[model samples]
Target: MDTIAVDPDLYAAQSAYAPDDWQSETTSIRSSIYRGLMDNGRRIPSDEQQFETYEAGHLVDLILDSDRDNPLFRSPIGADRERPLQVLDIGTGKGTWAIDVADMFPNATVRGVDLFPPPVTWMPPNCVIEVDDVLQDWTWRERFDLIHMRNMIGSFDNAEWDRVYEQCFEKMAPGGWIEQLEVGPFITSDDNSLPEDSALASWGPILQKCGDRAGRPCDIVLTMPQSIKNAGFVDVHEKVYKWPIGPWPRDQKFKEAGMVNSQHWMSGMEGWCMWLLTKYGDPEPWTKDEVHVFCAKLRNELKNPHYHAYHKA
Candidate 1:
């Protein structure tokens, strides 16, 4: 794989913390993998993770694009006629989704809020990024026409998640739409080819254990629709998309999506697992070396064509 070339301006736009400071913060939980630091102090992998994020956004666009009936969202706001639309994207990593949506609907105002500032220097005039944590109280004055939350499966605990939906309700205009896209942590194999002892098989349980111990469970995807409805959203609907972990599918579209999806998970395995396992792995906590070894094994399993594993979003 080629080294992902990140724009220098993106690095320059990062918060004032020096690279050394970020390194110091991760020392206790650091692995051999050199993870990059977000302004909010979370450790992400290298430029590969950024590229994966961008590519993942494209995959979602492709999925939504194919659904010509409800292209952007099932929300009625944008479907009928042209009017000013307000959109809020929660946990907007790198602001890719917000930028894309802003570009798609040039007349709409798109605001992305995240713990870290967005790296990109240029975006549509209608699009803006703000530094904010969604777990806290929301203080926005304007009500949004559409609220989008995606890929934030492991970010909140039970109570925090309740508050998130409530805030979405409070901040949304009447008849507004709230759409959340999250992938479940569990990996499944349709062909039952995955070995019971495989590293890929163990990944979800380990993450669930860690997340439970840390007070932020990873199973929110299962109950999010109900939560949204409880928060007063009417006409709630959900559509599941199965993403193959590797390029094992026969369908052309799924094959391409799986290839990108596989690469995304492969490159991000270390960054996602190391700290969680080190901090919360039960029975025995994992050392950096152990985490590294486990990740290597998991990556190999991901590449094995016989595994035929897929995750749902």
Candidate 2:
């Protein structure tokens, strides 16, 4: 990708807070030792990064109707109030899903594990957060009634998947359910309106190349259902949801979700591109300026309603 000079005023009007407040709030959250960083060596947990997490979570919930309704796919661990339940949310960014699940099932204890600490000032008594890497050895055996993993697409290597699934199987109770949610790296369009040369079209291959060089290919979504079954989880079910990147869908529900998803992608482009491209792209790593130029192009593509593109999960 070519490194074009980005106009400083491109995002000037989008700032919602003063620069000082943004810097201070971001600095306050920088004390966590486990926090990940971009190739530029900047910590990941900034005000903008946290907002992307919240926005993406909200968009997915809207698309899946995960809030205010039970999952259409039922778990073997039925709703028996007499039996105490234990829930595990792996790679829970910001602990949003865990907190919601805890609220939904008051009797169930929800535990969220991730490298970074959760940001909430208050959490339900039944909900707790643990800072740990999921790829490491899991000490808890047969301890959970349900295991939930979401948006963990680019976090693990190809060789690590089997072991991770095996660990999940070992940690779940006899009749527990394991649900894995992920968006495929590829972008598609029903009407073929998405230009082949568009920045959005180029995103997947670039990221995939980065992942391959980093030893963690991000194509696991294509094979996770089989992997789960191989791990000895019975009755594995996969439900694919298409999330429009722009507000071009006819259905009101999808249109709403598409709007939010568009915003989510817009806000997340910088953070996503910077680290992956800088650290793993072969031949030559992408500089911050090149990432900025690429992201500017991506933002423009995301807003083009004529593209009619959507990503599947």
Candidate 3:
């Protein structure tokens, strides 16, 4: 019988916080999520990573704004009790952002659409999570007050992205705002703390090449502004962030944010790269074992205290 490949990247993370047999009964959707500790895979680590909120976007928010009181979305759609607003979140991974927005404004009906349905068992009365491919024609009857997407880099080819944006333009109400955020895959160091020959340094270029071959470029953060404008959106506002990968920053806020963000990486990196590398790896498509070795090296490098690498978010 052919053996199932052990995901060494997830195994490394599991060994640290969970037993070796922790994920004995795991979910398998291209390794997109797990189901060991909670109903949804996103709730697997609540004890240490602050999983008090299921589907931990709380940690994501800490880094996004140091857990400040910034609005769930920046789109000023005038959502209130009087005028029910229509909000849409494309590529709503785990549906945390959409749920949060739904809870924030009960008057607004929030709809989250993704290619894969979340393992979410419960949802806000006003929030709806649906499985749909955005590249296809949209079935939403009502125009949206706000359309949002984030962490969607490399999810679409250039033409697909253009089509998706065009759909967003067509489906949105007049004066509706469209918001998107994408993170850079490259890790950078201001003081050369990350070595040039290290796996950390090479990861970005490696995946960039793979993503290019896959026809879904990973450098979406750099090109999105122009792309959004090209899609007929005007007056685009841009915000760039340096999200530290580990708790190495001197500042208290960044240190805390980094600590949480490290979990984000340890848990998320392999899933992010698996399909791309296995399908479009340089010189040849990589075996799962080869990707495992690469992820192991990166995990070690990421754990180093001296490296001050931050991803552009």
Query: Among these predicted structures, which one has the highest lDDT?
Result: 3
Q: With candidate 1 superimposed using the best TM-score fit, by how many Å does residue 136's alpha carbon deviate from the native?
A: 2.9
lDDT winner between candidates 1 and 3 = 3
TM, every model:
0.80, 0.80, 0.81
Q: Over the stretch 183-265, how does candidate 1's per-residue lDDT look in tens digits?
A: 78888776677887888888888898898898877777888999898888888887877776655665545554565566567
Residue-level error in angstroms, candidate 3, position 80: 4.8
Worst 10 residues of 1 by lDDT: 28-37
What root-mean-square deviation over C-alphas does model 3 reach? Answer: 9.3
In candidate 1, which residue ranges exceed 4 Å CA deviation?
A: 1-51, 57-72
Candidate 3 matches the true fold with a TM-score of 0.81
TM-score of 1: 0.80
- Record all residue pairs in model 2 with backbone atoms less than 3 Å apart, i.e. clashing: none
Q: After superposition, how far is residue 216 of candidate 3 from its true place, in Å?
A: 0.5
TM-score (C-alpha) between model 2 and the true structure: 0.80
List model 2 lDDT by residue over 1-313, tens digit each: 1111222332442321222232342332221211221222332344647555553544444444633246422465636866888899888887767876787688889999989886666688999999998888986643888888877877787668888889888887867888877878787787687988888998888888887888777777888988888888877777677777655665545554565566667666687668888887657998888888998888777766567777777
